[model samples]
Structures are given as C-alpha cells and as structure tokens.
Target: MKDRATVVCVRDNRILLVARERSRWALPGGRICRDETPNEAALRELSEETTLAPIELTYLFQFTGFNTLHHVFFADVAHHARVQPSNEIAKCRWFVPVKIATLSASIPTREIVELFFRYIRTLESDNVHRISQQAERVSL
Candidate 1:
C-alpha cells in the first residue's frame, strides 16, 4: 500500500485544513519520504505547509484506503498557524468540524476526519469511567 500522512493541527476546536496546490481540501501533509518515520514526515510536512511546529503531536492511526496507506496524526499547538501552502498545498486554513462536511474533501479523507470525532467521543467516555473508578477506590 502507498504510504501517505495527514497532519491535523487543532486550534480553538478547529482543524487546520490545507488545500493542495492542485487538489481538494485536506490536511497539511503528504506521502511519506524515503527512510522517514511517520512522526518525522509529519513534522516536516506540517512545518513546510504551515510554518508552525507543534508542541505535541501523536499518531492517531493508519488508514488504508484509496490505494494508499495513510499515517494520520493529531497535533496540539500553542498558537493558531497562519498557513501558506508551500510547494505541495495551494492554500491552508483552520476549519471547524461543521465546515469540514461542506469542504471538497476526498471520500477517504472525510472518512478519516469523521473517525477523529468518534475517537474523541470514545476517549472522553473512557476517561469518565476511569475517573469514576479512581474515585471509588479512593473512597474505599
């Protein structure tokens, strides 16, 4: 499978979506470079496209679709990046989840984007359960 990466940087509950120079709306990233790890490639592409380094970046998962293997990542930045598309992207801008549905995203791209929200919901639920358990243990 082809190796690609989608770099998602969130600021103010919105996601930074990069419009490729000649393609539709997507994240600020590209295909994996030779001998480059997913984190390395993500950092490089995010910097190249947005000119901002993330304070924290983590791998979300690997999405295999559209004849390519996509290494997806989520980043939390201290500041909202003012992005100017580099050689790969034509434009970049932050977007809320609602706006995402209206954008011109690829089929697989939207699927992955939606997955993040689901992940967040699941994570929050799990955290709540863990906290409750911890409270019970403390009271015991």
Candidate 2:
C-alpha cells in the first residue's frame, strides 16, 4: 500500500477540502516523499495544495484505506485564513461534518473525517470526566 500524508485542517468546526479538475473533493495532502517524515510531508502537501499555513499541526493517527495507508494529521488554522488553490488543486472549500455525506468525496476522506470527529468527542469526554473528578475531590 502507498503511504500518504493527509492533513485535516479545521476552523470553526468545518474541515478544509481540496479538489482537482473532475476529481472528488478530498483532504489536502499527497504521497509521502522518501526523503521526508509523514509530519514534514503533511505540512508540505497542505501548503502546496491550499497555500494556507496552519497555526498548529498535530499527528492524529494512521488510517488504512483499500490501497493507501494514510498518516493523518490534524491542523488548526485561523478562522479568517484565506485559501488559494495551488499546485494541481483546482478548488478549495470548507464543509461541515454533517454536510460531508452529501458531497462527492473519496472513501478515505469520508472515513478519515468521521473517525477524526469521533476521536475529538472521545477527547472531550475524557476532559470532562477528569474535570468532574477533580471537582468531586475538591468538594470532598
């Protein structure tokens, strides 16, 4: 399977997606170069495709597709960040998670997105639980 460095850029609860002419909208990313780590490739591909630099980039998890192993990364960018489609990308847009099901997107893109949101919910739940535990301890 080919290894791809995929970036999921989020702002205002929306995800950034890019597309080439006649291609389905997909996350901004590309194949990982032999000379670079997945982290480096993720950043490079994001910049190359969207011309939007993220304020923060974090390694998420690996997602295995039919023929691609996606090294997924999460990126947070300013809400006002302007995206210019560059390189081979013909267009760029942000879409809400709920809207993803209606769009023409790659299977990997859709799966990765759904998985990422679940991961986020898990993190949020953990944080809330920790905070509640701390509060109970303080009360006791």
Candidate 3:
C-alpha cells in the first residue's frame, strides 16, 4: 500500500489546507520519509507544508487501496497563529467544508474533507449532549 499521512485541522469552523499549483486541495501531509515513522513524517510534513503545528497528534485511521496505505491523523491547529506555504504548496488557505468543492482540489482531498466534516458533526452532537446533561444536573 502507498503510505501517506493526512490531517483535519479545524478552527472557527474552517479547515487548514494546502493547495498545490497544479493540484487540488489537500491536507498538510505527505509520504513517509526513508528513515522516519509515519508519525514523524506526518509532523514533519505538516510543519513543512502549512506551518501549522498541532498541539497533539495521533493516528486516527488507515486507508488501504490496492497497493497503497494512507495513515490519517486528525490534528488540532489552534496553537498556530498563522499558516504559510512551504515546499510542494502553491497556497495555504482555510476552507469551510462546503466551499472545498468550489476550489480546485483532488479526489483524495475531497474525501478527506468529507471525513473531517463528518467527524465535526459527531463532535458537535457529543458536545450538545454533554451540555444538556450538565444543564439538567445543575437544575437538580
């Protein structure tokens, strides 16, 4: 499987993404380096591409297709003050999920965008549930 890393960094309802000159929108990640673990490669790639460093990073899921494997990581980039493009990137921008398709982005990037929003939906639901429970307890 082809090995890669992807991240979903959301802040203010926008996701940090990297756009290449001749490519579609993509996450801030890349292939595993020759001597680096997936985590190491992910951190390095994220730093190099968007310059948005996550406070904490971890492996979330893997996508194996034919002969390639994608190691996905969901990162929180709240700590990053601003993001700038480095190598392999034409521009760095924050995109709302609905606006991603309007931009020139790759299929893999679109898929990652969908996954990120789905996760965000779940998180919102969980947050609402927790808030309701807390409100009820407080009323008691």
Runs in model 1 deviating more than 4 A are none
- Per-residue accuracy of model 2 over 1-140 as CA lDDT, tens digit each: 99999999887888999999999999999999988999999999999999988888999999999999999999887788899999999999989998988999999999999999999999999999999999999999
Stretches of candidate 2 above 4 Å error? none
What's the TM for model 3? 0.79
TM-scores of all predicted structures: 0.91, 0.97, 0.79
Q: Higher-TM-score candidate among 1 and 3?
A: 1
Model 1, span 67-98: residue lDDT tens? 98888999877773455667666787878988
Model 1 Cα shift for residue 132 (angstroms): 0.8
**lDDT string, candidate 3, 53-86, tens digits:** 7888977777664455778887766654788898
The predicted structure with the larger lDDT, 1 or 3, is 1
Q: Is candidate 2 or candidate 3 better by lDDT?
A: 2
Prediction 2 TM-score vs. true: 0.97
lDDT of each: 0.82, 0.94, 0.79
What's the lDDT of the predicted structure labeled candidate 1? 0.82
Worst 10 residues of 1 by lDDT: 80-89
